[model samples]
Target: MVTIETPRSPRNRKSAQREKQAWLFMRASGVVLIVLIFGHLFINLFSGNGIKAIDFAFVAGKWANPLWKIWDTLMLWLALIHGTNGMRTLVNDYTQREGIRKFLNIALWTICIALIILGTLVTTTFDPCPDTSVASALPQFCK
Candidate 1:
């Protein structure tokens, strides 16, 4: 016999609102992510000399500007949150144990937060000039 499991908790106004917000966020973020991803790819692989031009200096030059920094940060944040939420939904649906479901959801959000922090830090704090003992190995722009 097949059994239909119902929600553990009855839906309330606040929870319903939260669900609606999450759904809206997923849709909006997905559209933005598509544009950001495509733009990133176009710039990285189709502009100028293409993939061959994607060296340290190429990255440095892009990051040195504020616009690219914002774009990348947005992409990172949106993608991570979107993916994490999707995973959380999956865990909730599949896991029969309450403890397991909660644990997986917490782990997902923790990882998402950690990655977003690290990625933002790297993007915002990127330094084009590296002071190296051997300057020859450094990009020409570093000189």
Candidate 2:
């Protein structure tokens, strides 16, 4: 006979609380992501020369602004975290083997962290104007 856990039980309560928090986070992050994504699309596609204006120089010019940098960084961080969390929920639900589940979770987090670090570095340290003898190769904004 299977026994059902009581809602008031300490163990059940803790698990329930964690699940509740995760659920709330998913909803909050999803809403924020929608706003961020739409804003990004509007700026990149509708403004200036429209989609045709997007080139290496366009990206370099945008990142030159601290505001854009912050906006993009926030978007990157949120997107990665949101995706990782969703994947984690799937892994938890579908994986039956403890060893495999643990491995998959660890792998997922490790990959997410690596990508976040790489993306943050690229966004923060990006220099559109680099010292080079080939001036013609640089974006027009750099010249």
Candidate 3:
């Protein structure tokens, strides 16, 4: 003979709720990431001179706009977090040892946080037209 556990039993409620939230977050973030990625690609690859037009000055010009800065920042944050969360889920599922699982999760989050911080700083504080003494080194648009 076998016994069955109820779906909403007290013992399972907390984990169930957390899992539900994670599932919803994954779906929502995936959809948003698709839009952000496509928009990024369209603007960068299709709008202007295509792939050939994506040199330093092109990036500098784009970052000059606050709107583009915000857009890139959003894309960076969402992509990093979304990927980290998915990897966390995978680590939780596959790693059998508790110690290893904990260590891997910590490492994953640490890398994710570090990358996010670095990427955000670069995106927000990027300088397209640096004040350099050398004139020829600068792009034509900068001059």
Top-TM-score structure, candidate number: 1
Query: Which TM-score value belongs to model 2?
Result: 0.85
How many backbone overlaps does candidate 2 show?
0
Ranking by TM-score: 1, 2, 3
Q: Which stretches in model 3 have alpha-carbon errors above 4 Å? A: 1-12, 131-141
* Segments of candidate 1 deviating more than 4 angstroms: 1-10
Candidate 3: tens digits of C-alpha lDDT, residues 38-92: 9999999998889988877788888878999999999999899889989998997
Give the lDDT of residue 85 in candidate 2: 89
Worst 10 residues of 3 by lDDT: 3-12
Global local distance difference test of model 3: 0.86
Query: Candidate 2: worst 10 consecutive residues by lDDT?
Result: 4-13
Candidate 1 residue-wise lDDT, 69-113, digit = tens: 999999999999999998887897799998999899999999999
Model 3 clash count equals 0
Clashing pairs in 1: none
Sort the candidates on lDDT, descending order: 1, 2, 3
Better of 1 and 2 by TM-score: 1
TM values, all candidates: 0.88, 0.85, 0.85
lDDT of 2 by residue, 66-142 (tens): 99999999999999998998999899878889899999999999999999999999999998887667667567766
